[model samples]
Target: MKGKYVEAKERLRGSIAPLVTPFKRNYEIDLDKQRELIEFQITNGTHGISVTGTSGEPSSLTVDERITVMENAVKTIDGRVPFVPGTGSVNQAETLHLTKVAQEMGADAAMVIVPYYNKPNQQALYNHFKTVADSVDLPIIVYNIPGRTGVNLEVNTLARLVEDCPNIIGVKESNKDFEHVNRVLLYCGRDFLLYSGIELLCYPMLAIGGAGSISATANVEPKKVAEMHNAWESGNLEKAQNLHFELMKLNDVLFKDTNPAPVKAALGMMGKIEPVLRPPMGLPSKEVLKEIHQTLIEYGKDVQNTFDM
Candidate 1:
C-alpha cells in the first residue's frame, strides 16, 4: 500500500485525459478505437490516462463493459503513463466490484464518484467511501461532482475520510465553486492531490496548488492542454495563461450540449473516432454541430473537409 501510494503520488499529475468512450455507429464499445485514443494521448504529451470517467459514459456501460474498458486501457497504456479508471457507481456493491477489478488490473488508482441520485448525506458519503477504500489496496481518489451527483461531499467530511482512511489519497473536483477546492486543500493539507474535473477551471486550479486536471478538452487538444500544465510547472505563467484563454472557446464548445456528445462530434470531425453515442445520449442539434464545427476550425483542427457545412 505504501508503494502504491508513492507511485500514485509521483505519476498522477498533469493533464490526465478523461477519454470519451468511442462507439461504433451501431453503438457497440469500440475497443480498437479506445486503444487509438489512448495512443493519441500518449503520443501528444498527455501526462496520464483516466478511462471510463464522466466523458466515457460509464453510466451507459454494463459492469463487464466498464471492466473491459479498464483492462484495455491498462494494456494499451503499458506503463507509459498512469491509468486511473472511474470504478464508481450508484450501487456500493458494484463500485466495490469494479474498484477491486481495477486494483487487480494494475490501475494506478481508483476514482470513486460520490453516489448519485440517492443524495446520501456526508456521514453516509464518508462510510460509503471508507468501505470501498478499505476493500482495496489501490489509492482512492474521491470524485465530487455535485451537479451530476446531486450531493456535495463537504470539506469536513472529506477531511474526516482523509484522517480515517489511509488509502483515500485525493479528489477530482468537478464543482464550479472554487472555494470548495480551496477548503479541501486547506483542510486536507497542500500535498493532498486535487485534480480539476472542470475544464474552464483547470488553469486556475493548477495556479492554486492543484496537481492537474482530468480535462475533457484534452480529448481534442492534448498537446495544448498538456503544454499549459508543463508551462505552469516550469514557471511560465504568461504562456500558461495564454494557453488557458486560447482553450476557453473550445472548452465552452465541448459542454455546449451534454458533454461527450459535442466532444464526440469534434473527434469525429477530426477523423479520430465515430461520433456515435449511446441511447438516451444523442448527438448535438444541427445548430450545435455547426458551432462545434466552426469552433474546431478556429482551433486549427482539420474539420473543413469533414463536416458538410
Candidate 2:
C-alpha cells in the first residue's frame, strides 16, 4: 500500500531484547547503568533492545522521563543495534504523541500495545494500530498480550491490519496461545516478523519459523539467550534445549514478582547495577530477596556484597 516498512523489518528477524531499566536506590534513572545495560546486551550479542516496553515499566515513568529515556538510549546506542520503543498510552492521542517522538528521535520503529482498560474490539484494534502506523513513517510492531492489555488481538483483526496497513510490520505475541501464533504465521507468511513475546517459549516459536524474541531474561543473560538461539539455528537441538532450561529457570525467577523486581534484584546481586524500583513496584521483600540470591548462587553466579537475603 506504501513504500517499504518491510525493508527495515528484515534487519530484525533476529534476536531482540526488551531491556530492564536500571534505577538508583534513590529511584532516579541511572544513565550510566542504562548505558552499561545496552552495551552489555549489544556486546553480549543481542540484536536490539525494545526500550520502554512493559518489561521496561513504562507505567512507572513520566512523559518527560519516557522521552528522556528514549533520547538517552538513542544516544548510548549511537546507531549500532536497532531500537524499538513502546509508546502505548491508555489514550490514543498520547500514544500518537509518543510514537511521533520516537520517529523524530531516530528510533528504528515503534511498538504500540493494545489499548488497556477500554478493551477495544477487533475493529478498534485494527484502527488503533493502523492509526499509529499511519501517523509515523517508521515501521510499527503491535504488541498483543491480552493478559496485560485485557483484550486479545484476534487473528482476523491482525490479518486485516497487516493487509491494510503496510507499515504494520510485525507483532510481539505474549498470549502463550500456539493456535493464535500458528494462525498468524500461516496467514502472514514469511513477510512479517512474529516474535515470541514469551521468553521460555522462544525455541518452539523459532521451530515454527517464527522470528526471534523480545525477552526480559535477556537483560541479565544476553549471551545465554543468544547462544541458545545460535545453537538452535546451527542444528544443535540438544544444546538449545539445555540452554532453554537455563532460560526457563531464570525466567521463572523474573516472573516470580510483578516483574523487574526479580530481574532488577538479580542485576544488583551480580553487582551489575543497583536494585531500586519506583512506587507500586518496590524492592523485593526479604523472602523474595532470599530466593533470588539462593537461585543466583545455585546458578553459579556471584551473590556477594551487592545482594543479601
Candidate 3:
C-alpha cells in the first residue's frame, strides 16, 4: 500500500482538468462531446483527466450514468495520461461501489469527496475514508470541499487519515483557507500529494510544494493552465505568475454563477460542447453570459463567429 501510494504520489502531479460532463440540449449526457473535450485537454497539454468531478456535475448524475462516464473516459484516455474519476456520493454503498468500479475499469486513482448533506463529524469523516480506503486497491485522493459539504475536514483529522490509511495518498483542497493547505503539508509530510481545487490558489499551492491543481478554468483554457504548471515546474516563476494572473478573471467568471454553467457557456461559445445543463442547474444569467462572451473574446476566443447567443 505504501509503495502504491508513493508511486501515485510521483505520477499524479500537474494540471489535472476536472472535465465537465457535456450534456445535449435535451440534457442527456453527450458522450461524443465528452470524448472531444478529453481530446482537447490532451492535445492542449493537460497532465491528467478527472471526470465526473464537481465541474462534471456528479450530484445530478445517476450511479449508472456516472459509471458510464468513467468507462468512456478511461477508454478515451487510453493510457495517454492519468484518469481519476469522482466516485464519492452521499451513500457509502454507492461510494464504495463506484470506487470499485473505477478500479475495475483501470482508473489510475479515485477521488472520494466528503459526504455532503449528512455533514459527518471529523471522526466519522476519518472512518468514512478508512472504510473506502480499506476496500479498494486503487489510490484514494480525498476530496475536501467544505463549502459544498458543510463541514471542513480539519488538518489534524486529515493528517490522521493519512497516517492510518496508506492508500489515502492525496487531497484536493477546495477550501478558501490557504492556511489549511499549508498545515496539511506541514503535518502530512511533503510526500503526501496535495492538489489545489480552488483555481485562484493553484499556482500559490504549487509554490508551497503542492502536487498540482484540478482547475475548472482548465475546461476552457487547458493550454494556459498547463503552461502555468509547466512554467512553474521549469522554474520560470515570472511566466507562471503572469499566466496565473491572466487566468484569474476566467476563474472568477466560472463561479460568477454556479459552477459548470459559466464554464459550459464558455465551451458552448468555443464550440467544444453545447451549453446545456441538467435540471436544477441552468445556464448562466444574461448578465453573466454577456460577461462570459466578453471575457472569451478578450481571451482570443472567436465568440462573435462561434457563439450563437
Give stretches of model 3 more than 4 Å off: 304-309
Error at 299, model 1, angstroms: 1.0
RMSD of each: 1.2, 1.7, 1.2
Q: Clashing residue pairs, candidate 3?
A: none
- Model 2 residue 157 CA deviation (Å) reads 0.6
List model 2 lDDT by residue over 156-175, tens digit each.
88988888878888889987
The alpha-carbon lDDT assigned to residue 65 of candidate 3 equals 99
lDDT of 1 by residue, 232-275 (tens): 99999999999999999999998999878999999999899988
Error of 3 at 235 (Å): 0.8
The residue-level lDDT of candidate 2 at 96 comes to: 95
Minimum summed lDDT over a 10-residue window in model 1 is located at: 300-309
Cα TM-score per model: 0.98, 0.94, 0.98
